[model samples]
Target: MENSKEQVIQLNLNLIVARGPPVPTIPVPVVAAPPTITVPAFRSEKFSVPEQFDGTRSKLLEFTTQLRMKLEVNHDRFRNDAAKVIYSVSHLEESALDQVVPLVNANLAAPFSSITAFVANLEALFGDPDPRGTALHQLVTLKQGKVDFATYYSQFLRIVANLDYNEKAKIDALTEGLSEDLKDAMTYRTDRPDTVEAYATMLMTIDN
Candidate 1:
């Protein structure tokens, strides 16, 4: 019996020795870092200012005075004609004004080279508290270059269209409230002769 017990103990020791200590788990190696991404910088050229209009301030004042005189003399006819033209080329001008003015006014530093830029500036000026500001803004913005002269005429026709006896009265009152220089500046007609002639031709064709 003692020999049997001794044999059993030796069998247990042999089993433990054969099993051996637990093997340590090998850690997984990390891969190389991901590639870095870089973005290119954007560059833009500086804008150049164009030659200023000769006697622009004085001319603008004179124009405004002339416009006021015309408005006063042909008040009824102008209002009626303006209302009629609203739906024609004038509508396009107003639509453009609504788009371009706000953008230009917000960025005064931007160049006013293209019609698009001029329109934007006009839109911004329209929002001014002063009526003269609105008028001058419209005039200056439209006078950017010859490319937009046609557009300016169209817009002018639209403005005329919007004017009625009541609107004229309001404008008159607003003008009265402004400084004389501003009132005069608002009068200048920057519209192209060809455009005006075309507008006249178109007007003649329209039924009363």
Candidate 2:
């Protein structure tokens, strides 16, 4: 039963702009930490690519030496013996390529326990254990046959250089490969030369 006017009193509701309390502040220090250098985890540069091996007996040493150097530098990639052997087999060609391709195809690592064993296998297959003896045998059995003097001489020098023959022995070995005509010409017209160089000169002169 209160008066209707009192019940209908107007609310002031004036436009009010309110600022919120400032957020909790963190103290800023004057000096900042110096920039840190980021050290690289590994060397980005890699070694030179190895020479492809074609299973030549004379070149086995070179091929193996270069491959070892390459593998050592890329040790991160070749963490295990299998990895090293597989990487080595990647640099093969011709008979060398054929010899191990099957193992790789079968997803096999080196048949032996270590990469060194794998290399030893390669050595047995492709390397000359008796280079000096082989060279001597080649010189002893060589014959000029139908080939020209230049060709025969080059072959002779290449094989002979591997041996330690003295001049007289060189002359004696050189006598083995002379063509029949060269032998006849030297025997009849030429005086035997004491030095192997003189003998070689005389034979070349007759051949030309």
Candidate 3:
């Protein structure tokens, strides 16, 4: 019995020795978040032309002439073909003015009501309501200068001067939006016939 008790004590000691100390757990490596991408605000620096040659007058003339032509040619068809007229006219008008005039005019005419609606739409879309919204509000108060044919001829000159003031910034925005190869291909000068022809063709192709 003494021999058996000694053997049991030995077995218990062996069992305790078999169990070792707990191993320390390694911590999980933390993953860093990706950096956010920000698009720079459009600045018009890259396509600078001399103050005298930003082509605002030419653009305005081309726009007005094309609009006048389309109006004359399509006036009869317009009553029956509202979609086609609207498409052609809107493209020309938008290209010329950058903003839709009829809609702008409508909004301006009903300033109190339309501005509230415009503001609500902007907020819903999460659009910035600073410069663009403010500029639009200013449109309501814009008055057409007195019209004379001679004055009209000089009107483009004044627009040219204003364009010159903003040329670098305007061109920068335009060039930034263009691909590098295509950026060189686009010209702002009024001297190029090919550019003029291409624009005219684009306008004419809508109807054809």
Candidate 4:
């Protein structure tokens, strides 16, 4: 019996030796590096400024939109707003610069809040807020005497685009501008269009 008890004790000792000690694990935290951003360069030299400030507002806005898309920056902080404005208007006449330079110099200093704010400031100083005056005059004065329907249609649409005219006014302007023979023939049609778009479609059919 004593030999058997010593043998059991020996077995327990061997098991403990085989198992070894418990290890305490410590987790190390992982750190991520800041993101890097690169903006695409614009060839500002390729663009020329408009002859006058009358239609330059839209042109500049379009330019800024293209530039902002290319840069892919959320805010104007990457390129100084003032610098961007100057670059945009650099190709304009000296008279245009005379107006824009001082205003930009005075107003566009420091951290820009957003691209919208920057563009708004420049737009306000560049041209008339409403362009309906010139656009309406052009639409009213246009006539399709010798020009083809497609050419006349393109010019008609361009002028009417800037006007704040309703559907009725648009349809009327379109009908009135057609050649005398085409206008007469369209007026006699039983399916004379009620919508400006439908009228435009009919005109396109004539063009085709």
For 1-208, candidate 4 gives per-residue lDDT tens digits of 9999999999999999879786768889988887877788553433333232333654664555565553344233335665554444554455546765665666655323445664565566764566778787788799988888888888887788788778899888888888887876776678867888888888778656
The stretch of ten residues in a row with the least summed lDDT in candidate 4 is 45-54
lDDT of 3 by residue, 87-190 (tens): 33334322332433555465443322332343343233333335344433433333223433233323323333333325444334323333333434444434
Candidate 2 backbone collisions, by pair: none
Q: For every model shown, what is its TM-score relative to the native structure?
A: 0.20, 0.45, 0.19, 0.52
What C-alpha RMSD separates each model from the true structure?
Answer: 20.5, 13.7, 21.5, 9.1
Ranking by lDDT: 2, 4, 1, 3
lDDT of 1 at 40: 57
Error of 2 at 31 (Å): 11
lDDT of 4: 0.66
lDDT of 1: 0.41
By TM-score, is 2 or 3 better? 2
The segments of candidate 2 whose C-alpha lies over 4 angstroms from its true place after superposition are 1-37, 109-112, 135-208
Best by lDDT: 2
Question: What are the lDDT figures for the candidates, one per model?
Answer: 0.41, 0.80, 0.40, 0.66
Give candidate 4 regions above 4 Å deviation.
Answer: 1-112
Model 2: lDDT of residue 183: 86
Clashes of each: 14, 0, 5, 0
lDDT of 2 by residue, 145-206 (tens): 98877788888887888898888888888887889999888788658898877888888888
